[model samples]
Target: MSINTNQFPADGNISGLPDVTELEKLANELFSLLPNEMPKANFSPDLADHPRLEKSLNLVHDRLPSLFSKGEGFNLNNPQTSLPDPHFPVNKTPQSGFGVSPPAVRPGNELSLNRPVSPNSITTNTDYPGLDHKQPSVAGSGISPSAAHQGNAVNLEDPQTSFPDPNVGSSVGLGHVPHSVAGSGISPSVIQNGPGYAEAFPFSPDTPFEPDFNKLWSSINTFKSTPQIPEIPGTGGAQYYFLQGAGFKGNDPFGINQNPTSQLSGKTFSHIQNGAGHAPFDVNLIKKDFPILQERVNGRPLIWLDNAATTQKPKSVIDRITYFYEHENSNIHRAAHELAARATDAYESARSKVQVFLNAGSVNEIIFVRGATEAINLVAKTWGEQNLNAGDEIIVSNLEHHANIVPWQQLAAKKGLKLRVIPVDDDGQILLDEYAKLLNPKTKLVSFTQVSNALGTVTPAKQIVEMAHQAGAKVLVDGAQSVSHLRSDVRALNCDWFVFSGHKVFGPTGIGVLYGKEDLLNETQPWQGGGNMIQDVTFEHTKFHDAPNRFEAGTGNIADAVGLGAAIDYVNKIGIDVIHQYEHYLLVYATNLMKDIPGLRLIGTAPDKASVLSFVFEGYKTEEVGAALNNEGIAVRSGHHCAQPILRRFGVETTVRPSLAFYNTCSDVDILVETLYRLRGAHR
Candidate 1:
């Protein structure tokens, strides 16, 4: 008789072979029991017919010869006689009239049904019975044989084999199967492996077979969600931790936590205070601090006129560096060792010293760099890169040293920025009107030197800084020359940034200070990446540290920094006002004496000048003048002074430069002037 595809009796009886879904569910349950590493069959169950099922079983037997023997065949046409009872124990012997042998089973071991069976052939649970007794019944629900077989098919060649689902009208692969069985609320693998299966399978009347997709997606979304990052407090703009207690509303004008006098750590400024109050500065007492003054050059007592090049270190500064290396020698921060703690305290203390010296509001505003060159380059690469766009203008002065000039030039060249220069008058002073003309909406940054290194011109620094601010431009004052001679009050100047080298201020070399406004430093990104500068680092991303730490990447010159602190202490003790007055008196005395010589021409004669004295003697090369001065125990620089543009502007390749300092006396100036006069006569 032809099979009826859709006829059912009132008792829920169906006549022919079970449909695809029931067979697939049974096959999935069976396959899930196997270990994941077991090789899976690749055959499709939809193609399984009585004839093909027999052929597939034969193929499994052929491939795994030791597992299945040839004699264990069964006939699907008479399953009632050949199959064992559905409810009775499977270990019981079969009754007579059976045409098939029982499925092979090893004692105390679960059955391995690695081959597929035709749906019609499996009429009862016991028909293929070596499944663990503890396992859940695949057919336990009121599902009749016909219902269990409906819509399900088993691929005999492979349990993982995929087949088209007639109910869904599409193919679903084994890998795509839902992790938990539909309606059962149990994992597919758990259902097939043993004990818990009986309770997990056979859906109750209240539970439907449909999967709850909404709940599944909700769990996935929770797993993939990102955590919210906490905002750092006190920064006026974006949320970031303020370094050195800056960026918060406070009564202190400079934003420092402690008073400037308190930060001095009990160091006395009495001498400086007395001198500023018109007490005469003891030149002998001041000269006692510089040990290098005692050295003889070419058998003559040394007269140092190279202060503009680099100042000699004071005894206090040298002692401070030696003490650091001897007692507090260790890398700063992130260590539990005693030396590290001391080193870190000393380094940060030095930073506070710089902050106080510059009259900067916070210690975070000060970044320790190698020298003035690196400080300018850092700002150029970090702030310049972020702010400068094509056609933007950067203003520099004709009085700028190469440290202040070259970095902007390179940045302007790379970023297509316009570099505008404020011209200087014949006296080497920056023309205020010309500088005002350079100020415009296009000016992003105005970088100029407070005191010209090549010449003695002292620009109107506070006025220039105010103009730049009015024009909506940030200003950087190169304080390399002026910081030693004049008091640097960054708050009063209102410049966005100021830079100076420690070596120029009677401190150690390889150390400098970059003082920026707290808000500006917070806005600028770090130009380098390495240890200490970063808070966290990964192959994919890096989070940087705040302000000073962000810019100071690796191990800094710790000993030198402490020495710079000592130098600041020295300057404060002696007083910058006293130094300025005494140096001015010496400059006038030297100028008058040198001008009396007929062949000498002073190169830079600005009235408001500091310590620099640039000149050219008639019929004598600049280098020859320097050598003659050296023979008389006077040391002067003879070069472009790294201000080539300014030197070339004056129509000269180089000049004989004798820059003075407070340590230089009237006697030193007299000897230098007399030596220049003798050299001029010899040339004539």
Candidate 2:
């Protein structure tokens, strides 16, 4: 069944689709122009070119009279804009609507997300390695309860269904008008003749009624900053402020706090530590941070269950990347100009972020590569080529990704070296006894993934590293899967090298990280030599920069590295511990539902695992189940997931995988299970 999410739910609120984060942000800015009592002006239709926004705004503009009737304290003078019924408590999360209006501002409240946060203060230290750089510091702020403000918000049943509804004509102030309005679909003569249409607009087909306010902005007094509600986490163009404590200082007239950091303050947006000290962050609000969550597929709202393959980017991250190109776009270490300096600082700042994020010993230890794949290949080509001689053995777990296996295999094949395997028991966990047997004197490197992407298994990485150290072998922990879900402590793991991709953890593609021990990196020679990597070039010989710069070769993915830094900033604000906890809940919720389904066999049943669910249906092919789910708008990866060995070990060629994230809700899982149950009933 194709889910029509726009319908009102029978229960408390329509919940579980993670769309409209960006929409709320755009609406927030647009709402900043309206008065608390009256929408002095309709937003010029040209505010954004987004078709969904265009249709939604157009519909809302036409339905203003209906809003006045439905809302409390309703009238043109005191136009209280809220999406849900006005009687609902302010603290309750509004049953997951994507309306544009900020919650209603009760008379004399503090500014919400309008406070200006300094760039340097964007801090939050989470359990995720290196992200927890500092705690959110607030000098003067006050906390308030959550509010249900859907003012200016349009509740479209299917936002994708209408760019400009065929039944509706273009309103005034929109830059472009339909060439043939009468022929477009609906004629103005028919509209004027329609029961209430004449009274609604009171204008002929040619002369459109103009709005009250001409410009996009309204009176400065129009904005009533309500401190009770949390700011929408991160927005591309929108600024967010969370003020809390008690008495309104009234220090700044515009409600803009001078001393604010992007570091989450007050209730910490929607996700906060409750009185019981539990991270009960609302997933609905978190979903708003990511704009892409609103994407629709096959005319249905997208349920992004393919998180293991790649996570979605938040507005903060996207904005940061845009800010870089728009302002500080230049190659680093090449010029003495302003842009060059800005670019250098941004590029190096990203490295420091990686250092703080990974808790690497020093900034020099972090090297930017294309991704974890290249990072591994860098290790094989550099240290493997330099240190290892013929007959040296390499140990890899059966739970390894192809990236970990192929590099060593190629190295071993070229050098005539021996390759050893560490077997895994059922449930896809690495066996310590088998691993111990393989770790002999000749075992030069023990490489493995901390978390299996294919099965969602979290290996005992610290133990693996310790054992490898005992055998006098160098250990490399593949953190591609683990970094996003678990706390990473490279020093604590005591591994010689740690590699992960930025894209896997909410950063952009084409950029990854290689954290090498300072000494180990300095000792290794660069395989790819270029301008920046070279200290100086002579006719006879050339010297190279040490460690990171040596391996980085030429101009690296500097912009994306800066983007990775922004991603770290975003994750830091949310706090990884909070994210991990919520994801664990989502995982458990999804797992229980899957287990109850008849004829479903779950792969990778390890007790210590991340948020990946791999299962095969008895009567259904993996691809078939995946297709059925897609028809209803859920996304799941169905294949070997690039870990053929692990799947073959589990007695299956492939499986259906739906991975969870913090943005996912119980409602999403409910819909998923409902579809699967329907499928099973039909099969029976």
Which candidate has the highest TM-score of all? 2
lDDT of each: 0.64, 0.65
Candidate 2's C-alpha runs over 4 A off are 1-280
Residue-wise C-alpha lDDT for candidate 1, range 115-216, written one tens digit per residue: 233343422233232211121122211112332255243211111221221111001121332211221122222222222211122223242321222222
- Write candidate 2's Cα lDDT for 1-684 as tens digits: 011223435432334423345434544555553334323244444545644345545755563433323221211111122122222223334433334122321221111211222212333322111222221211100000111021111111111111121112122222222121221222222222222321222223242121222111111011111232222334221111121122224532222222222211111123334223322344554565688888888899888999889989976677667767866788888898767876787788788888998999899999999999999999999999998989999999999889999999999999989988888888687899989988889999999999999988889899999999998999999999988888788998989999999989998999999999999999999989888998899999999999889998778888899888888866765567667655654565467567768988889877668889999998999999999999989999999999998899988999999988777766667668788888899899
* TM-score for all models, in order of appearance: 0.60, 0.65
lDDT of 1 at 510: 98
True-vs-predicted CA distance for residue 291, candidate 2, Å: 0.8
Deviation from native of the Cα of residue 11 in model 1, angstroms:
99
